[model samples]
Target: MSEAKMNPMHELSDNVAVPFEQARAMPPSVYTSTEFLEQELDKVFRQDWLCAGRSSSLPNPGDYTTMEIAGEPIMVLRDRDGSLRAQSNVCRHRMSTLLEGRGTVKSIVCPYHAWTYNLDGSLRGAPAMMHNTAFCKSEISLPTIRCEDWKGWIMVALNPDATPVGEGLAEVDALIGHYGMENYVESFCETHRWNTNWKVLAENFMESYHLPVCHAGTIGGTVDLEKMTCPEGRPAFNYHWILKDNTMPLTLAHPNNTHLVGDDRNKTYLLSIYPALLITLTPGYFWYLSLQPDGPDHVNILFGGGLAPEFRDDPEAATHFKALKTLLDEVNDEDRGCTEKVYRGLCAKSAEPGLLSHLERPNFDFARYLNAKIQGEG
Candidate 1:
């Protein structure tokens, strides 16, 4: 929507730098340029291993979810044998999108042409192809996409040879394994569209500087900006940890907040897996956002979150989940204002990139990660 005002010739790379203090945030052009967004679809998102939420969301044999990555429709399904598969959601017959949202289906039946596919993507039925000997049913199948289940989170890639998400997050697992994230059961999951570039949210999630100003009514009181530590990560991810203050209502002690051996027990790690996964983990709970660009000014956010297993079964779990989701919504409302305003301001003729805060060190790290991908080094 804001595309008409963007400078097509803009190069955000010119505005960004290293040694964070010496660096500037990505220029407004990067966020509002339609040309750059198209490049991102092919260079970054499609080629990178992007997350597709949790395996637990589709634990049943036939449970499935439909996703769109870099504009490609995808079907993430669990077959009867218990293996998860990511296949192109387009049907071979007429190239129609096979599924819309998510549900348990015995088989994928095209609503338009009646072409059916098995849980594993094998063509199960063709309405009128039996007489055509040239069209072999056995040879017809949906294109398979590369997918993986890393510690219960499903990650998929359009590129046949993208880096494995498990390998990318091995160090992350080793670092936060004590949190027992595998035992974290999702109490809430949702997808919402934001009227801003995906990068806005990515950077917002990485820094602690905005908490006091943007989220003052919610998480702001529970965190200290000076305590944030942004550390470099493997090629596929970057992370920062923030010390928790005792003031916020959300920080109350829970019986399930366990397994941490030391200082980490008091800190929450905000890890952004390069390209598009954001995972926030504390001792008692975890939440994440799988960001996807819909257009230059639009982003589709896939979010998932839950508390540790020991907390979910509590009699108050339902009420607690409701409160948790409400709190999250409030935080998101604050973030939305910042991102949307920034995006709108970027479209102005006077908008220019500015210096980064030390708190934005992680944000700059992500910018470098993006630059490498834009240069084909990823």
Candidate 2:
């Protein structure tokens, strides 16, 4: 393709070159173009360390969860030795998918051919393969993908040389280490497909400017927008803060908590780990969305959250979680409407970029990150 045809986002490169105060939303093509989405699949999603879910989700041997990243079926499982492992979910024989959704199993058995494999992904049994001289059970094993239990998140990378998740997020750990995020128990996780570009949802999470209006029925009134801070982002991530003083006890520092004090006790962090792990970390609870592009027009989300250790065993823990989940679902519903509308507007020929607000500094940073990755500058 010619240079003009290859570069879909005329606005993206320009947005990255200017100062944050002068930045604007990415051009509509950034969200509507099929070509641009393919480029992202190759350069961003395929090469980045993608979060699968929380490590605690698969606690015992044989427990597992499955997800697709950049069109590759991946399964993260707890091996027999009590280690987290990721491998191709596709069966070697007949190329069938070995697993579906999340569950525990003694071993991987291909539903197509009844071919059996151990928890480690090594082939154990294959029927009627003796006639084939090339069949080697010893050599037939599911391809191993790079997997890491970074803090508590299960991260996997398709690119063998991708930066280690821990090293990439070292600064993040330093920023929120006192919260002991790794120990937070994940109470629920569910998958949903949304009709909006992944970037729209990501950018929404990066700012609080729309919270009061967009989340009016849920957390809108609870947020003090003036107290929020949107600073310039780092190479691997962007972050902002919301100082909350709310009725939700799980969002504030628990009585048993000693790590945070004063304003930090009610502080909430909105962290966007490029290319798509968005975390909402609080003193008492945490939630996150791990995103993947279904196409230019849709995104697949793994949404999950739970309480900090201090609140998990409280007598009212169950009730608190139920309320939290209810609130979250409402918030998500509001977000879905907003983002989908934005996408619909983008798809129109008259769509144009708009200037960013100070609260959208993280959104601007995210644009720069996408520009760098797709242009091979990162």
Candidate 3:
């Protein structure tokens, strides 16, 4: 039998085992197989430290946000003592979910039974349980999960034994730290569902090779393809950069910004954190997408962006951000169209992956990352 007729998963393993210079795009089955997706949910999503959102959004003690990781509902919040906490979002009494979306709450109260929990995941009160001799409020708190704040991003891990977020991102921090990314303020965060595999959207963000074509109507006109560089990726993430003069002034360093020097001022970094956090970081602004797989044909996305502190106080800040938001929305629409089309093609019986370009180095690394994780190498 030919290589094309071999087992799909084994073919993927062989493809990733090759070098970057000889790499091909991952097989269609990587995105189209339900069995493979189930493995990804367990090995990749469940074992990784996923980005929740910006910690700045939870400045107040009662502020919290909820998300589901590999079918496990979790909430990240600010405790009363000014600490970050991650815990099960399900109520202990009847296993009902305690929160939805984002909001401020004095205490968690399950809508189903009004079982109250403190911000620290402690059981503050449980009505009518006093009569049950078997009940002990002290031992009935929500289960705690591993949570951490790395730079500005709130990270939560479903697996207790996962590596610390900072250790894996040390190199990324060193590269982008001068910009004070931790101080960047989030302007908005919204959740949306897309009709494509999560990996499809992720691979789209990892390369700039398609920008000039896929995003031509939006921000692609400003791109100089030759000026882009895709270097070998680190174990925890993959990144690429486009060094050029930006058409949007807000994307470049502000006049008042003095920290960044030379090319750093004009650098646009595309960072893909393992599993599913994609970030576009520029000198003056940043945006990100946190992806969750719903199934082989769908993904849940948490999309957000914000401005650096230097740009926030500018006289025309509001107008600049308003225009920036509009542009990003257009870019997102273009990406949606391209990735959804790719998914449709992958579903076809004749779907086959083509050779990868030099600009797609990150995608190759991502494929390797996925393969390693799924094979229990990590």
Candidate 4:
């Protein structure tokens, strides 16, 4: 079979069944409507296994991280017994948010009324609440949440009955197991507020169709569009691979990460884990972006990743990292411009859905994922 014929990833004919040449893009309101955003928060973010950060970040007991998902304040921490726990960051006393950011905490204390909780979500103390017989301080605790550690990724789900993160992502785990992602160290963690819808960045990360025009000076030069291949999209995620020569600078192949063979050694994998997880894995290095939709017009990005262990110890690692950051910033600036302009155009009165390129199978999958959540089929 021809390469295109063998690819199960596109599944264009079987799933959507509309020929790519006849497929139209999603309506622009899907990106700009306030009503749709609310539905997504409830159906997508609240029910899905949202990636938090690396498990290594919370290695020690009491070490915790905090974030706001679907408007609910959440905390993930390591308890004294050395297990992971997720809980609401809202104080039980007066509903005031309990934590601001992340750190090791012996106990989570509410700044407003002095209510305190142990790392396990147990009520530690309720200062000055003993005045009334009706008050039951010992019985109150922060509402616990569901959390799981999958490989090195930490994730939490707001829904009590949500699928276990490990079981939920089992297919993805086995699909890319050769990467040895568990040992990958997170060299940097940054939060950037971008003036673009989260989906714009999400789709950009998944497709190489825009490389020649968008990253013309950098990555575009290294990739041969003809050599690019889109694998079939799995139920949990989507991936595409493109062959690049062994001489690329930013991601020169490393010894420890060389298990992939055939075109795999020369191939770079661009993967999207549904709604918000975007990862780029090469034979040498890797990085990822976990997106948080701030609103219709803004996205908060959690971006960072680095070289495999072998490359991390390189004498020139600092120099290489600095150059990578500089180059990445340029590419990011270009992407931000594209997405921001797209968002602005989405608001135009004459805006209409456009055609989908054969290269944009990822976007088609994204549209399908959104449709599923919105229609309660996923």
Instruction: Give each model a TM-score.
Output: 0.94, 0.97, 0.98, 0.90
For candidate 2, which ten residues in a row score worst on lDDT? 1-10
Summed backbone clashes in each candidate are 0, 0, 0, 4
* Number of colliding residue pairs in model 3: 0
Task: Summing lDDT over every window of 10 consecutive residues in candidate 3, give the lowest-scoring window.
Answer: 1-10
lDDT of 2 by residue, 1-378 (tens): 457534675556866788877888888888988988988999999999999999999999999999998889999999999999999999998999889999999999999999999999999999998999999999989999999998899999999999888898999998888889999999999999999999999999999999999998878877887888888899999999988877777789988888888888999999999999999999888989999998899999999999988888788899878988998899899999999999999999888889989999999888988998888988
Residue 250 displacement (Å), model 2 = 2.3
Candidate 4 lDDT, tens digit per residue, 1-378?
A: 466433322322234556555666666667777766787888888888788888878889999888789888898999999998989989887899988767887888889988888888888788786677888866788888888888787888888898777777788777777767777777776678888888778888888899988888767888887888876577668888887876565565565444766666666788898778888876666778888899988998887777666567778878767776677778777887777888888889898777877788877877777767766888
Q: State each model's CA lDDT, in order.
A: 0.81, 0.91, 0.91, 0.77
The positional error of residue 167 in candidate 2, measured at the CA in angstroms, is 0.8
Off by over 4 Å in 2: 1-6
Whole-structure CA lDDT of model 2: 0.91
The parts of candidate 4 lying over 4 Å away from their true place are 1-17, 256-258
Tens digits of per-residue lDDT, candidate 3, 1-378, equal 576546666777988978788899999888988888989999999999899999999999999999999999999999999998999999999999999999999999999989899999899888888789999999989999999999989999998899898888899888788888888878889999999999999999999999999999988887798999999999999999997565778779999999998999989999999989999998888999999999999999999999988888789889868977998899999999999999999999998889999999999999999989888987
Query: Regarding lDDT, does 2 or 4 come out ahead?
Result: 2
Candidate 1 residue-wise lDDT, 46-109, digit = tens: 7888888899999898899989988799999999899999999999988989988878999999
Model 4 lowest lDDT segment of ten: 5-14
Instruction: For candidate 3, give the lDDT of residue 341.
Output: 96
Scored against the true structure, residue 226 in model 3 reaches a CA lDDT of 91
